[model samples]
Target: MTQIATIIGGGVIGGGWAARFLLAGWDVRVFDPDPEAQRKIGEVLDNARAALPGLYDMPMPAEGALSFHDRLEDAVQGASWIQESVPERLDLKHRVYRDIQAVCDPAAVIGSSTSGFKPSQLQEGATRAEQIVVCHPFNPVYLLPLIEVVGTPANAQMVDGVADTLRGIGMFPLLVRKEIDAHIADRFLEAVWREALWLVKDDIATTEEIDEAIRMGFGLRWAQMGLFETFRIAGGEAGMRHFIDQFGPCLSWPWTRLMDVPEMTDALAQKIADQSDAQSGQHSIRELERHRDANLVGMLRTLKARDWGAGAVLKGHDKTLQAAGRIADTLSDIADPARPVLTVDRAVPLDWTDYNGHMNEARYLQAFGDATDRLMQIVGCTPEYIANGGSYFTAETHIRHLDEVRAGARIRIETQVLSGAGKTMHLFHTMYEGDRALATGEHMLIHVSLETRRASVPAPQVAEPLARLAKAHDSLPRPEGAGAAIGKR
Candidate 1:
C-alpha cells in the first residue's frame, strides 16, 4: 500500500516537510489556502529533488505521487499521516485539528509543526486531542534530519510508530520524554538569538560578525560533535568534568546578555537585514541551497567514512532507501547478450580532477567500483540481501588507463558480467567520456556470508538472478584488455 501523507500548509518549513515525505516515496496531499503555495512548494521540491537524492550513493525509491487539494478535508481523508503546519495560532491550530479529527483516519498520526505551542496547548478545546502531537522540524526540512517530537503521556503508545515513520523518511526523531516549551534545540537557538539581538542593539557586533563567529569558528565543530561534545574534547586530558570545572566559573560572568531582551526598533531590524543582504546578496536562494548541499555532501561523506554522526545516519538510511527500490532490476529489464549494463552516467565535477587538471587515476577505480555496485544490485546482491548477511566481496581488480578525462566531462560506465556462478564472479567495466573509452577495470569477486566473514554460496534467490544476467551477457564480444597484464603493453 502506498503511504499517504497530508501536508496542511506550504510555507518554507511546511513545504520542506512535504518534500521530505514525498521524496521518501510517500504519496503526498498538500492543502494550503494561499494561491502561491504551489509555486512556493514547487521551488522547495526542486531544491529537494537535486539535494536529497545526492546524499546517498545508492538509488532512493521512485518519487511518490503528489497532488494538491483546495479543501482541508479532501487532503486529510484517507491519509496515513497528517502534518499540520499552518501559522502557529492556538485557536487556529485547534480548529484545524477539529477538522482533521472529522476526516482523518483514527490511527493516522497528526503532527503539528508549531515551534512555540506545546501539545497540551494545541489539544485545548480540540476533539480527539490525544491524536495531535508536536513534531517541530527545522528549516530545509528536506536536508536537516532532526525533528523534535513531543506529546502528552496519553499519546505515548503512538510515539513508537511515529518515530519509525520519521526514521523511514530519513529524519532523526528526538522523542521528548517530557513535553516542554520550545523543546530542546530551539531552546538553545533562542539563547543564541537573544544574545545576537543584544549584540546588535548595543552595537557590540554586526549581524555579519555574529554569523562569521559561527561559520568561521565553532559552527564547524558544532556541525559534527555539537556543544557538549565539542566542549568535552576541549577538556583535553581531563574530559568533560574537568573542562566544565575550568569553564564553570564563567557562567556567572556578564559575558553574555542572554537574560536581557533588546528592543528591536525598525532601524535595528533594517540594519540586520541590510547587513545580511550585503553579506549574501550575490547569490539566490537556489544557489545557496546548492552551495549548502555541496558542503553538506562533502561533510556527510567524511563522516560516512568515519561511521560517525549525521553522515552515519545518512549512510544507514541509504541502505533503507536502496532496499525500498527496484532501480537495479528495472534497469536490468533490458539486459541482453550483446550489450553491457550501462550502470553510471554523471558529470565529472571539478573536485574529481587531480592537481594536474585531469581526472585522477583513483577516480577510475571509484567509477568502476560504482559500476560494480550497480552490477551487484542487479544480480540480487542488494542492500536488503547484504543487510541479511549475504554479499559479494571484491577479491581482486586490474585496470588500464587508456585516456585522460578533464574536469566537467560527462562520463558513463558499461559493465559486462563475464562469469557468475555459485561462489565466484567476474566483471569488466569500461569507462567512457562521451564515445571515447577512457579506461577498463577487470574484477574478481566472491559471494560471502558477512556475519561469518567466510566464503559462502549465495542462497538460491540470489544465485538465480546472477545466473540469468551472466547467461544474458555470455554472447558479448570480449574486449582486448580482458586478459592483458600490467607489463609494457
Candidate 2:
C-alpha cells in the first residue's frame, strides 16, 4: 500500500519534506494558503529529482503522486504522516494541530517541523496531545539525513514510530531524550550564529570570510567525524582527556562574545546584507540552490563511499530500499535463470563523470564490480558468509568501453555466470543505457578463505546456487566481446 504524507505549509522546509516523501515513494498532499505554493514546491522538486537519486548506487522507488489541496482537512484525510511546517508561532501551531487531529486518523503521526518549540509545548491544548511530536529536520530535507525527534514520555511510542517512518524515507532520526529549547543540533547552530553575528558586527570577519574559515578548515573534519570525536583525535596518542586538559581552560579566556547579542540595527543589517550581496549576489536563488545541491551530492557521495557518518545512513537506506523491492526494472528479480541476471540499475552520479564531461573510465569497472558483488550475494556469498571465513577475490578483469555516457544517465548491468565451479567464478557483465550497450566487463574471481587468504573450495550453501546458475546460463549465446583483447576489434 502507498503511504501518504500531508504537508501543511509549502515553504522551503515544507517543500523539502514533500520532496523527500515523494521521492521515497510516499504520496504527498500539500496544503498551503500561499498562491505560489505550487510553483515554489515544483521548483524544489526539480532540484530534488536531479540530486537525490545520484546519492545511491541502486535505483530509488518510483516517485509517488503529488497533489495540492486548498483545505487542511482534505490534505490530512488519509495521510499516515502529517508534517506541519508553518511559521514558529505557538498559538498558530496549536490551531493547526487542533484542526489536523480533528480530521486526521488518531493513530497517524503528526510531526511538527518547529526548530525551537518543545514537543510538550506543541502538545499543549491539543485534541490528542500524544500524537504531536517535534520532528525537526535540517534544510534540504531531501539530502540531509538528520532529524531531531523530540517527544515527552507520554508520546514515547509515537516518537519511536516516527523514527521508523523517518528511516523508511532515508533519514536519520536522533531522538531527543528530554524536550529542550532548540533541541540538540540547533543549540550548537544558535551558538555559532550568535558568535558569527558578533564577528560581523565587530569587524572581525566578513560573512564570506567566516564561511571560508569553515569550508576550508574544521568543516571537512566535522563532516566525517563530529565534534567530540574530532576533538579526541586532536588529543593525539592520549585522546580526549589530554586534549581537554590542554584546551579546556581556553573556554574561559573571553575569546568569544557568545553570551552577548548584537543588536540587529538597520545599519548593521544593511552592512551584513551588502557584504553577502557582494560575496554571492551574482547568482540567482535557483542557481545558488543548484550549486548547493550539486556540491552536497558530491560530498555525500564521498561519505557514502566510506560508509561513515551520514554516509552510513545512506548505505543502510540503500539496503532497506533494495530489500523493499524498490529498484529499477525489477533488477533484483531473476525471472529467468537461463540468461544474464540484471544486477545493477542506477544513475551515474555527478562525481562519476570526468573533466571530459563523460562517465569516467574507472567508474565502469566500479559499476561492473558492483554487478559482480550483486551476483555473489544472489548466489549466497553474502556479508555474513564472508565475515565468517570465505569470499570471492577478483583475479583478472577486462573492460571494453563501447560508448560515452554522461552523468545522471540511467545505466543497467546484466551479469552472466560464465563458469562457476570449485574455487573459480567467471562473470561477464554488460552495461546498458536503455537499449544501447555502453560497456562490457569480464572478470575472473577466485573463491578464497578469508583466514588463509588463498583459493578455497566453496561452501555447500554457496556451491549449490553457483552450480545452478552456471548450468542455467550455459545454454545462452556467448556475449559478443567476452574474450576480446585490449587492441582487438
Best by the TM-score measure: 2
Residue-level lDDT for 282 in candidate 1: 93
Per-residue lDDT value at 293 in model 2: 86
Q: Give lDDT tens digits, candidate 2, residues 1-489.
A: 989999999999999999999999999999999999999999999888878888987788889999999888889998899999999999999888888998999889999999999988998988888889999999899999999999997788767778999999999999888889999999999999999999999899999999999999999999889999999999999999999999999998999988888998999999999999999999999999988888989989889989999999999998887776633233235678887898888888877889997999889988999998889888889899999999999988999989998877888898998889999998999999999999999998999999999999999989998899999999999889876752245
Q: What TM-score goes with each of the models?
A: 0.79, 0.90
The residue-by-residue lDDT of candidate 1 on 1-489, one tens digit each, is 899999998998889999999988899999999999999999889777766765665656667999999888889889989999998788888788888898789888999888988898888876776788899998879878889999997688888889999999998899988888898889999999999988877888888899999999999899888899999999998999999899999998889878878888898899888888998989998788767765776676677767778877888897786565433454345535357887776556444667897889887888899889888877677798899999998888899989988754667788888888879888988989778999999888999998899999998877887788788888888877886642224
- Ten contiguous residues minimizing lDDT sum, candidate 1: 326-335
Best-performing candidate as measured by lDDT: 2
Cα-lDDT of candidate 1: 0.83
Query: Per-residue error at 191 for model 2, in Å?
Result: 1.3
Task: Quote the positional error of residue 117 for candidate 1 in Å.
Answer: 1.0
In model 2, state the lDDT of residue 203.
97
Task: Return the TM-score for candidate 2, rounded to 2 decimals.
Answer: 0.90
